[model samples]
Target: MNKRIQILSFLFLGLSQIVFSQIKEEKLILDKKREPEVKKIEKKKTSVETIKNYPPEEKSANPVTYDITNVPAVSDFKTSTIQGQDISPNFNTDYQNNYVRFGMGNFGKILGDAHISTVLESKMEVGADVHYLSTTGLKKEYDWNSNQSNATIGAFLNNYGEKGKLNLEANYGLQDYNYYGIYALQPTSDTDLKQKTNRFTINGNYDFYSNEILNDVRLQTSFLSDHFSANENQGAITVNLSKHRLFAGNDFKMNTDLGVKLETLKTDFALLNQNKSSFFNAALLPEISFYKGESYLKIGANINFLNSRNESLILPQDKKSEIIWSPNVEVLFAPQDEFRFYAGVDGGLKLNSYAELLTENPFLVSDIELRPTNTKYHLYIGLKGDIDENLKYDFSAGYSKINDMQFFQANSIFDDVYTLNRSAYNFANTYSTIYDNGNLSEVKGSLQFFPLQNLDLSAELLFQKYQLDNLDEVFNKPLLQATLGAKYSMLNEKLNFGFKGIFVSDRTTNSFEISPNNISVPTAYVSTENRNKKVGGYADLNLSAEYKINKNFSIFALGNNLLNVNYQTFNGYKVIGAQITGGVKISF
Candidate 1:
């Protein structure tokens, strides 16, 4: 009885499996039948009409009516209408018309490069840029617009060596600019129009390496010139030297660079307006590293110094100096092949000076009247780590403080009664002067993460605080921003599509003092009263593909802003609309 039962169980299991397979096949067939189909149809029609004629038609006679004498004549009415007309007047009127204008200008560049051979390489590039732009829609009355263009031609020659290499490059550039406009209201219009600029640049680089104490060294220099349209000329020269791995050791390395650049700017604004400026910057960097198993630590420091001077014939110019020093330390911990953690901190201090040209008389100022200085200090710390095969994360935070900030203050006197010392024949004009000694503080933080291989996301936040002696109250605010983007590959990885988005939020405040003796005077002081709020969002879809039609010919198409969403990213500026462009490329 047991054997018989086992046999029956096996038989039943086999039959059930066969039945399930057959049912699935039948369902699939039914699904295929339910799908729609396309077919052709033909139609035929037939019609019949019958007409019967009785006899030939005959024509009938006409009836007449008469009223000849009472109708008005057209000739009499034409003479009556033109009988009393006075069509002569001699008059003239003259009036002055004025207009305020505002406008915007834009320029862009599309560049391409191709490699030719092993011994020789060449690149072709084109670029256009606008110089100046003004918009008068904000003021509602005055408008201004300006623009300029530039073109570049470049070529290079490279040589390969056994242990080192050499490269020589030369570039020629041309700039064309024009300025023409009216300043203010006048009986007759006068034009302030001029055009200028030409430039030439050359560069050379040499790299040398050896298996000795010195690892590698590079030297470079360049020269530039500006030839203006009104016969104004200026020139500049720059020299740079860099050395790597001056000392070879298991834990320490040194890299240093010293550079000096000089520039001269001359202008013929008033038959002779020439100025020469010079700039010098130098830095020294050293890095030390210690490695043990999967844990490592590195420390680095950078010492920088800069100096600038300007000499002018018609304007007051002065010399300025700055110094900055930064030191950083980083540590990395890696226990596995796929996971790692790293953190670092960098801090620095900066000090700089600027010369303010002030005048007691309306138009007679030649020397530096006020010298304002500033000092700043900043600290930054961050941590970054990677996980799995496709996930990565980074976080950073920073803090900064600035002291002795400087700015120009404007004051106007309408008459001699308010002036301490005044001449009756002196014209009434505004006087402006610069003041220093303010304080500011800032804090910022950001985080970036990649959840997948094709997606990127980031968020940032910032806070700022400002204080000044002349203001009624201090200012403080916070700002937040975020961005997300993704890319996908299709059609055998030959075509790529992407999308991106950004968002930002911020707040600001301003304060004014009502009295000059407002030191700690609560009645004359005001608190923050300004509040601003805004929200904006935009989305873009892009598709790009490269199709190889043949060995020597190819085609490509790029469609940007596919949905044509008209939006504004700024207060007064609007985003560019949708555009579609395509081109074919040929190689020989």
Candidate 2:
């Protein structure tokens, strides 16, 4: 019995020692965690790896809808320079094999569009499209006869092979408009106010899918003419090649681009007689790019040759030839995954084609001169990043020096005999292109927010300032611009709503100088009196809604200029007032 008691006592003492040791170890661990040194280390590493590996957010599935009516609102000008192509409305619709839509609104406005595509084989496809829009005269009192219409037809083919892809497209368009800016002056009749334009274009491209050298080739041709006997033809070809090699213990991509462009213009004026001009341009661009970790750098240069010839009997005889060299450099640095910084310096030559000018202002003088714009240098810096999974932001600033920058002014300033004898567009209703050396500074910012899975909101702002060498103001260029848009999807993605708003600050332009003697007469008499005019600021609001009835059919309604402000895009051309249209969409 005594031996059993001793064994039990020994087992109890061992158990007590094990329990005490465990408690002491746990207390030590808690005390260490409370220390300032340990707390700092824990905070530094919290979620660091998780954020570095976070995946990019998925893109929105719902498509953005566009305005059905083709209103020439001043809000359309988003920047100092107008860019992008005037594509048919059919190409802007939702992705479908076959689509059709039609709508109508006030001021005798009409919209019609259709697109058809079919797959002939596993690697071949063909498609065609047609678009039309028109509107009658504005308010009756204006007596402007501001009739306008646009029609276009296009066809395309695509072929895909194992190693390359080929694409071909052709398009023809007709535009009819009236020079109704006669409100600024007195007119006896609207006899010579109508204008018609015709354009044809063809484009072809081939892209190689390979790990080797050659990349792609492209060719384009276009012809444009108007009822006033003005015609233009243009053509261009481009080739791209690239290779990857190891240089200085780093992998680098060397790229080369070769291009050539030709343009010919012919114009017939009753007073100035016939004029013909030709322009030729050639360019070679070479670039090298290298990447290390999260940093990327590109160094490049552009070498160009420009030539122009004027073969005219009545107009001034002139010729020009020159060679231009410009530098190109770009850098991108990303210290972490959430932020990126980019900087670049670039420049190029911009051909001032008749078609391009007409797209900006339809009422252009037939005898206006053509010149090429050269950008000496452009320096820019930008930052882009994400605030969180639901918000993204981009901000940028830039400065540029430009030679032969184009501006528009009243034709009455010409003060030639043609102004007195011309039958149409002779008054202050027409515009002519002028050039000057200038410097531009700009700042821009944008934000995109997706608070919910089916909701999207965006806002953008731009500010621009210009300094001209000779000109008084940046003609018809806005100083400040803003755009806001929102989209929502609901009801199992069957119903959608969209809203858009545009705002622009005051724009300055040259106007007919008022007579110092207070005598009201034709502006042609006082041609030397040049004065500045301010076009008032304006805002445009648009709303759209769509409801799907089934898989193949949907109904939509669009409202434009909801604020009912009749603002002028040009000096005297005013757009239509508030208008609404409803249409049906079909897809097959």
Best by lDDT: 2
Of the candidates shown, which would achieve the greatest TM-score relative to the real structure? 2
Write model 2 residue lDDT over 292-360, tens digit each, in one string: 655678888777788887655666878889998777889988675457788999988877887878888
**TM-score for all predictions?**
0.46, 0.78
Candidate 1, TM-score vs. the true structure?
Answer: 0.46
* lDDT score of residue 2 within candidate 2: 63
Model 1, residue 164: displacement in angstroms?
A: 3.3
RMSD of candidate 2 to true structure, Å: 18.9
Q: After superposition, how far is residue 365 of candidate 1 from its true place, in Å?
A: 22
Question: In model 2, what is the error at residue 489, expressed in angstroms?
Answer: 1.9
> In candidate 2, how many Å is residue 382 off?
1.1
